[model samples]
Target: MFSLMYETPSSWVQDVEALGTLTLLSDHAHCELKAAATMQALVAKNPTCDSIVRTLPRFAMEELEHFEMVEALLRERGGKLAEQDTSPYADGLHKGSRANRKSLLLDRLILSHIIEARSAERFYLLSEHLQDRELAEFFGSLMPSESAHRIMFLRLAEGLFPAEDVQARTAELRQMEADLISNLPFEARIHSGPKQ
Candidate 1:
């Protein structure tokens, strides 16, 4: 049900298994925090966009709540949040975005949609495959919220931009996202490829 061009390799489950639960939870907590920050940043950047202004603060709060939940999970597993490198998956998407002011907002929204969609996909996989029942249930519970966030971003983009423009850009960014996912080295990250 996601709009992703790529399917995460099955090997990712094994990679996560090797990475261990604490490391995965720590990385997941960071992703949730970053998601919250990204939503807030979108609001700040496009204050005049009524749809964005009306919708994103709530979304931001939801992301923050998700972050807190993940943080609690980490602590329960005896892991504390630690510094990790920014996701190359995300950074590559940003680099692929058009820098011109007219395209920037649309691109950013599309990127957010892609990120959320990919996240939901990974969460679904984990929910089904992880041997740890608690973590599996937690990830399963998050799938709907991530999917909703993905749809919301896309709708916001469509509301602000021409339908055709939104479609074309979303398609282009989806391809870019797919390529980035394929190339990134495997790690215990929400958006990562198979270990080389």
Candidate 2:
């Protein structure tokens, strides 16, 4: 059901969405690596507790693999990979989360869940409009994994905070995610773009 190719741009819209999709993938890889690094440092200091830190090293490796896969896909498509700058999509959402430091872990987990959920949504949308059979299939394949990440993050948020608190935080982050999607900063990218 996934293999599809459309010759007409009017029918596919992948010409526009492809750049955005690839850009988002590269950004995801970058952000995942950064997060993993942060967790590593935190874990080292804690040394015995934080289960997250213990698991993060493996997560980081997987993120690197994902980065390579996306990069290879970009190169195969003759699309240039671009460096990531601060995306307005992420910056605005982060600003709101950073402002409230009292519940930092809960905030971070909620925000992370929102980000993953939005990514799954975007991947689904892009897959529907993509033309290349291979590319379409790739995006189609990413949805379930991203959804799983979203759920994991949500569970973390729930553990960190009460149900009511988690719900409120999730709502706030979801709105931020919607805003980020509605207003993207900079033009779309392929894999890597020149530093902005």
- In order, the Cα lDDT scores of the candidates are 0.87, 0.58
Q: Count the backbone clashes (under 3 Å) in each candidate.
A: 0, 7
For residue 188, give model 2's deviation from the true position in Å. 1.5
Worst 10 residues of 2 by lDDT: 1-10
Candidate 1 residue-pair clash tally: 0
**Top-TM-score structure, candidate number:** 1
Candidate 1 backbone collisions, by pair: none
* Alpha carbon lDDT at 15, candidate 1: 77
| Tens digits of per-residue lDDT for model 2, 109-150 | 776666666656556755776765676677778677667767
Q: How close is candidate 1 to the true structure, as a TM-score?
A: 0.96
Question: C-alpha displacement of 61 in model 2, angstroms?
Answer: 2.9
Candidate with maximal lDDT? 1
TM-score to true structure, per model: 0.96, 0.73
RMSD of 1: 1.5
The C-alpha local distance difference test score for the whole of candidate 2 amounts to 0.58
